[model samples]
Target: MRKIIFICMVAATLFACKSASSTASTSTEATTLSTKLDRPTQVAIKGNWVLTNVTYPGSDYIKVNSFDLADSKCFIGSSWNFISNNNKGTMTLNSASCTAFTSPIVWSINNQGLFVLKIVNPGTKSKNVKEGYLLKVAGLTDTSFQLIDNINVGGQVKDVTYQFQRAN
Candidate 1:
């Protein structure tokens, strides 16, 4: 019937419009995220970065007391320094739970252009058995920087964003 044909046409047209709108919105979001980073380069990421905040939802990491972010006191004096010439870095933890935790790390941008932080030597003898993660540069400026990393939890991957401020 003509009525059925008309209804089908309307439905298809509506679906098309929605798809176009969603595509446009996604493009806008990508642009926004790119702009926020200032497109941080190797030189831009060099220097001292003091941990400012850590956030993860429904994570047992918070309950462990070791990685708690509720008060941010655990990372109050933590610092990460990225060296300019060699792509090497260091992490210093000053909190009581993680005091004297300093380790050498290496960093580089992966093929996908995401930052990758790696521990130079995760020796079995060390008490601090922390590893590194690949980070997405969220935002970068002269005095501030932000990064996000994804971790798998119970088969579901979750994103954890860490914010930092320039120390020097």
Candidate 2:
């Protein structure tokens, strides 16, 4: 009886140690995963990219002239221009010029490779005027990166992919 009890105790102790070791390892893995996701991978997305697909309400696929990202400024032709200088974000729509639409856009990246842009007006304190998402393509290149925006309209989200090539 004493020997049986001793064996049982030893087995219980072994199980407890194993459980503790596994819990510690799992905690370490969780920390590592969070750190990896938080760190943004800097990709050079500066260049001229043709808008192969742009989906708006009541519009299927609209062809945009060209989009440019320079000095933290995202310019869509001469009509729409967004400047993110010094982390100060501002967007302007040149309806009279060429790029016309909106301004004061806020940009952020989520873990799921989704680039989000929230457009807000300057004077009006209203909700987000326009919101969009861009999905990252698999093969990331030095000059060009492919992106798809599907959930723009209510219809089926089509893969409007664009390959942005570096200009300067």
Q: For residues 1-168, what per-residue lDDT tens digits would candidate 1 score against the true structure? A: 999999999998988652221110110121111211123476788889998877766654543132222334465568889885776888777777744567776665543456655555556422233344456776778888777655555776666667889996
> lDDT of each prediction vs. the true structure?
0.59, 0.37
Clashing pairs in 2: 78-99, 79-98, 79-99, 79-100, 80-99, 91-103, 91-104
| Worst window of 10 by summed lDDT in candidate 1 | 21-30
Off by over 4 Å in 2: 1-39, 46-99, 124-134, 151-155
On a 0 to 100 scale, what is the lDDT of residue 146 in model 2?
54
After best superposition, candidate 1 residue 86: deviation in angstroms?
A: 0.8
Give the top-scoring candidate (TM-score). 1
Candidate 1 wrong stretches, greater than 4 Å: 1-40, 59-73, 122-132
